[model samples]
Target: MTYSPATQDQLLAIRVNAGIADLAASERFSAAEPDMVEAIVEGIGAFAAGEWAPLNRVGDLEGAKLENGVVRLPGGFAEAYADYVAQGWNAIAGPAEFGGQGLPFTLACNVLENLGTANMAFSLLPMLSVGAIEALEHHGSEAQKAAYLPKLVSGEWSGTMNLTEPQAGSDLGALRTAATPIESGEHAGKYRIAGQKIFITFGEHDLAENIIHLVLARLPDAPEGSRGISLFLVPKYHVNDDGSLGPKNDVRCVSLEHKLGINASPTCVMSYGDNGECIGELVGAENRGLMAMFTMMNNARINVGNQGVQIGERATQAALAYARERVQSARAGSPDKTPVAIIEHPDVRRMLLRMKALTEGARALLYYTAGQVDRGTLGDEAADRRGDVLVPLIKAWGTDVGVEVASLGVQVHGGMGFIEETGAAQHYRDVRIAPIYEGTNGIQAADLVMRKLGLENGAVFAALMADIARDATSDEPTLAALANDCAAVGEWMRDTASLDDRLAGSVPFCTMSAVAVAGWQLLRQLRAVESGEAPGLAAAKRASVRFFLDRLVAEAAGLKASAMAGAEPLYALTSEQLAG
Candidate 1:
């Protein structure tokens, strides 16, 4: 089923919730006029529904295939991708200096949301490209940027991040990939990279002329663990001095991964320098690859959060439509006793409202995070730190919402949701990968509890809570109170808890924090709806915010107990006993 766009909701999120007015008033984002923003949102919706949505089911069924070491996508993917490149979608938010429109990053976030909702697997290509673009724009040498940024920004060449090895997943220090400097020759300032990187998304695709890989590897004399790592610019095909395509590099896709979802996007086993000729240029300083890769990974993390919004929106659309059409038992105590549409049923209504509310809340949170990201990019240090704190919340909680909403969507469809043909299952399967990848939701929560809560001696976390409180209307104090409670948990984690305690309660704290933040965002949208600022979406937006507050937010307040629960109870059970 093609995605029915959530343009009105997205526009409301951008204008009301995300506070685009402040962004547009700034000299940096002067081009973000209301008309342009609306046009961009509408355009993305139309494009996704028309060009991208049709490929969603096909990609799931056909999947990307490995043929003679080359990855081939389902039919129409290449053409659709070419259309994506040609239309300048990739360049819309890129730097103006490198053939880009230089729009606010939030617009790009919205574009991805629509595209991904239409076709999540197909969307992975550009999604990965955007991350690579962000990484190169920040750390690549001027020469590297000059040679790579233009094409990458233009989407003529795709990009991949290579951080995972068979032996090293989250533990970067365990990585054995080695990069040895080639001291002399035509490629003198470069290094010979030799390693095997697995689970590389879009690692091998023919849609783009070249694939630029930002690899994290250790130099021969580098220190052990994450610190010794450095970022490298490796291309599938070498680029000439004049920017022409040259010979193929030693990097090759050994095989494509068989996966549970996102089959349209190639998850490849990449082998570099098996022939001992893989050459790469360093993107940043030695022993600082972690910092550089984090730049890319951070970008991906926020977008991965957006993936949650995408799948949730898609699932909601499918379930809502099914509920409206499927005939079911008569409403209780009806005089005529005739069958009614399932949408008339109370339980189904609750499920549908919950689905839409969570989807909208997740969308609002993603946009809020994106706005903070733009503010951070424009030099608001506090907003930047706030964005950092929001990332883990959105990534973990947002994906959790996606899974929950998708499951509910399945329930709305009854038994039909389980069968793949109905299309509800695709959303469930597609979104399942989001929480697993981009550092599993557990890792994101640990980052939230252990690393982020302590930023600026707790001031960043405090400021975030304060923002939520400020947004809370007197009529709706639940969100603010919840934020305060979540803030208390944050303080406890930073000041009182041991490392084990922090890690153990991390996910719960993250959940409570996300509920507060998302509730505040929905409140802002609710105010806009009530005030008639977004007249067209008034009723729907109002209901969504209300259901979120009355149901989701009210129920989440109980998480504080779990959030502050110490680690002792977790370790009380032996590993084997727990496993059994």
Candidate 2:
């Protein structure tokens, strides 16, 4: 099946929910005019379809190969990347001062969303680089920016995050990486970084001239645990002051992971300073590494959520195509016992509707969150807090929808989907990683309950839910009920529940919050259709939003009791008992 980027859906999200108009009106975003944004959306969709979609099967069938310590992608991967860079796609939302157009990040997200849907693994090479650009923009030294940003923004160089170790995993506090100061010499005031980092995406690829690593290591006199961690920039090739490449640094790609999906993107086990000569420069103040890295992680989290939308759209399209073409058993209500397309069957239609509703709902939630971030970028504190509160929802709930929709996509194809030739299985395998990485959904849930809920003394979340409540009209009964349920649960978690109880209920509550917000966002689209603003897709958009509120939103309300469930049952079973 050919992957098709949902350009119209993305446009609806951008224009209706993401507030592209506000962005266009801003002096800071003078480049994001209406026509330019439309051209970008349409342009990226075509580019992804023509340039990247063809490589989807090739990449999956011929995964990245490790050749004597170097990672090599299948044919066409490198050339497609070259086209991407040559066309200035990577610079769309980059810093204009550094060879970029400096457009709103919302547009960049649209670019990545299309690229990701067409070929997710290839998209990672640029996605990580963009994240790196953001990190340096916020926290890099002036010298660091001058030496790196221009090349990175131009896609001449790529970047990756060096975090997880075999032993450390997600526990940043248990990190054992070491960084020592260069006391004197030409490299004085720099650092010698030594660590083995695993699961580094595009870590050792030959797609760029060099790979810049943002490393987290500890200084000798640092405090214990995560607090002592410092951020460092370790490049694959030493970058000279003149923006030229120097000798190879001491970084090595020990091995590439053999994964179930995203095979085209090498997941490398990286060995930094293996020769004791790998050097790095400080990013931001010492011991403030996590704070600095948060800049990148936050950017990645939302994009990862967008990845969910990517997978969902691709899977939905695949399933819909198969359902429309495949003839099945005779229709239930027809007079003649003639066979019809599976899509004509009532049960099949329900499944397809479920997939559409869930995918579109997640898209609405994503655009809503992106709109808030754009508002926050324009100096709206209230908007920023609201966006922060919704991040976990988009990342966690959005990915969950991806998995669910992809699974349904497979089911829609019946036995063919289970077969490798149909390509449905690949989407399922690829999306399964979204919820696992970029801070696991469980981690997101915990963040929502333990930290985010308490932002501004709980007033921020309260205000957000209040807005949802106000938006949920009588016609939106599911949204209305869910708004009340989510609001009530948020208050109980803060005011009455124990910490463990709150933790136990965090996931379900997070899901409820997402469903409520998504339902309201969908309502915004329906309102637009009613106003004759987008008469083109009026009927289709209305149907999708109505199905979402009636079915999915209603189904999610059952989670309220689960969200309020205490943690006692979780701890009741011993580890051995649970294993048994």
Candidate 3:
């Protein structure tokens, strides 16, 4: 549903008064561009409310079917996709020369949030296409762009990134896919890709003309591991120089997976070059596929984080609506009285509040990160640096919180929530995938530890802490303490003599960072209340921040202890001890 202008304005004002709006003004997030934000909000909101919502239940129930090697989407999906392409939704953020709107990624993030909330299964196809388009645009030759960009941008066809092989999984070094140079006339300088890629989304869908598959393979003579990898654009149908469809390529979908969620989207196991002639063109320099594909994956990671926030928001809305209407037990003292709505109960209120806090906090964090990316687009180096630091934090932390928040939504509905009819159960099921995909949360923690902690020699993180410390300055003693705690931890990281030892504390450091950032935003939100917006708004912000610090920040201590424990103890658990 389209949220009222009043509501949007209110949220914006609250964010603004709290200094959150300053995030965009700080040139950290470019979505602050009024036109871009409005266009994204409007287009995504309309598409979400109209096409996607109506099909969500159908997609879940009917799902997708694979027969005779082709997967058929649920009824109404094709029509929906056609409408999506007709509206140029797929082109909103692509390069302008390719017939796209050429909007910044911040707006795209907003649109993706809506898509995920409305129906993630349907949205993934376009999302994946966007990723592939980005890879091609950045590294493809002029001829390649002219041939493929128009169709991709117009959504006449779609795209896929094939990286996860059955044996490879997360270890690109173990990838066994091969790319041998062709020895023929028309396909001279081309390669023949031969490998099986697993878990390829939209591998055999019929919504588009010809799927552009970005395959990662190693040339026969190339050195092993990630260094020898190369990216190839292998379309389902070969394209003539005139951009007309030619012979069918040999990429085939072997089968589809039965997944826990997003079932409407096919997860196919694709076999390339079974016929020994899947003609492929290299995207960038050979032996640099991993680097080329990484740009797309990083973008996807942030988008996945946004999906988590969207699902959480949807769950919260559903739970709040249900609680306000469903009657339950009356107050204990009110003897012989009729039962009241669960919303009237203190415990229920607490659960709802907890859900709201988690969802809102996650949303703020995600949106702030989106805004940062937008700022980066505007050529602000500091904003770009900050965005880099926040990306992993937002992705890992936001997705983790999405699962928790969705579960809490289920909890609010009690036994009814356990049933499929409640819909809250679906949100829980859907969001569980977020933390697992786009690299697991633990992986993110390790990245934060080994990689991000060392960024700019810790200056970027220190600046973030300084911002939190500034916001935490207040008359409230608890807030003041929180500010001090944030500042202390930041200083500790900055002053530590052992960089590796400090880096060892990345997990704890990230936890503290979450606390610091959330607290910073909440205080900003609290100021919105002070500015005479809604009294409840500011009060809720204060209470939530207080609850977060009081209930959650203590984990920082435990994390810090673990961080200080060093690598040896953490890795010391043997197989024999583990068996016991």
Q: What is the TM-score of each candidate against the true structure?
A: 0.99, 0.99, 0.89
lDDT of 1 by residue, 514-536 (tens): 98999988888887788878788
**Number of backbone collisions per candidate, in order?**
1, 0, 6
User: Model 2 clash pairs?
Assistant: none
Worst 10 residues of 3 by lDDT: 1-10
lDDT of each: 0.90, 0.90, 0.75
The true-structure Cα RMSD of candidate 3 reads 3.6
Across residues 74-168, which tens digit of lDDT does each residue of candidate 2 receive? 98988899999999999998998999998888899899999999998899888999999999999998888999999999999998988778998
Q: What is the C-alpha RMSD of each candidate to the true structure, in Å?
A: 1.0, 1.0, 3.6
TM-score of candidate 1 relative to the true fold: 0.99
Better of 1 and 3 by TM-score: 1
Cα-lDDT of candidate 1:
0.90
Error of 3 at 41 (Å): 0.9
